[model samples]
Target: MRVLVIGTSGYVGSAVAQRLSAAGHQVVALIRPDRGKRARRYEWRIGDLTDPDSLTAAVTGDIDAVIHAGTPTGDATVDATAVAALTSRLRGTGRTFVYTSGVWVLGATGTATADENSPVNPIPIVGCRPDIESQVLDFAGVGIRTAVIRPGIVHGHGGGIPALLVDLARKHGAPVVVANASVRWPMVHVDDLAALFGVVIEQAPAGTIWHGVSENAVPVRELAIAAGQAAGVGGEPQVWPLSQAQAELGASFADALALDQSVSGHAARDRLGWRTEHPDAVPDLREGSYR
Candidate 1:
């Protein structure tokens, strides 16, 4: 399969493009015109998500599938338009289209675990994402093999949000938790999430949604402590009041970090044989990548 992948310059998309190439698929990475022409294992095509013409031009007929793992442009209309432009070119071609969304769309799940079928209560940080998801899934009806993957807080390779905890610990002499000590987040290692993307691209039924979480609910306080260990700091993590965090990190993003959610990815495991090689994120933060 000749797969055209957007966002290859990003963390998740880079991992995904590598996995697809290793699995014997030809990967054509869509990148910005201004990006350096560094040699990569996969093919490169000039494009940008904000520019619909570039997106349309990049999806030539030889491409068998597309995985949209790009960061949103922060404008709902532009993002939606980008999706439309990409999918419109693939309409009636029976090519696959996979959109990357995040678990934050489920918002605060409290005690009960949310699944792919759970109703979405998105936080403000992901405003209009659910609507965009709906738009992508609707393409399945028009002969496009469209699917959506909602990944958990992605961590690994010494990057992502966990690195922030380590940075904060090094700066403040202690780790910091955004809200109360008990707030939780679902998580997935970047490589493991990439494997799931490969599976969905090859075998998912049209219009299906999958949760790419490995651990359903990891306590943020514990993660902060682990981050502190990685940073050579000691004692419990300091709690940053939500208001204070919002003032620094912006209200919507801070509120998202404080949300307590437990999301299950068992559907992918049971149905697609997607096993998570890295089961615990705490160790990765304390002794693995973040260290």
Candidate 2:
């Protein structure tokens, strides 16, 4: 299968590209040709989003599936334009089109573990994801195999979100919140999340929604302590209140930190048969990779 994966350079993309390659799939990673020194399995192409013609060469000929892993920045129009253009270019091709969405879209789920079928309550940063997903999923009805992968806090070697917690734990002089941390959040290793992509490309039906997560819900404060221990700051885990955490980390972060966003991945595991090799998020923190 000739698989075309966009943005195969970053943390999640790198891991996913590697896994797809190792699994014996022919991968063509849309990359800047200038990055010749970096090791990768896919063919690099120089293309601009504004000029769809540039990507015509990349998308044309014989391409089986397109995994849109490219992440856009602050501008909504730019991201929407890229999605629109790419969708237009690949329409009616009967190829798999996978989009990467995040768990933040589910927002605060209180204590109950929600699934792919659960309602989405997005945060400020990713609020537009659902609308974008709607456009992609619409293609499924047109003979295109469209799907979305919603991942949780994707922690891995290069210091992602877990690093933020470890930093807060190590730098904060005040007592951290370790009791009644009430927020429930889901987590997954980068590799485990990458495995889900293969599942989507090969097995998922068109318009399918998958939770690219392993553990659905873990207490917020407990996750912080695990981060503290991993950051080499273990001393009878401090039990600070939400107000206290707010005072130390600021209210915006405090609010986000306090979110109990737990969602179930039973659907993904049942369908993809994914097993997380690095199940513990805190241990990844202690390895100091977060540093």
Query: Against the true structure, whose lDDT is highest?
Result: 1
State the lDDT of candidate 2 residue by residue for 57-121, as single tens digits.
67754778888777755456766666666666567777888888888878888757788888888
What's the residue-level lDDT of 228 in candidate 1?
95
Cα lDDT listed for each candidate: 0.92, 0.73
Off by over 4 Å in 1: 36-38
Model 1 TM-score, all chains together: 0.98
Model 2 TM-score, all chains together: 0.85
In the predicted model 1, the residue pairs found to clash are none
**Best candidate, TM-score:** 1
Poorest stretch of ten by lDDT in candidate 2: 173-182
Given candidate 2, what's the lDDT at residue 281? 69
RMSD (CA, angstroms), candidate 2: 3.4
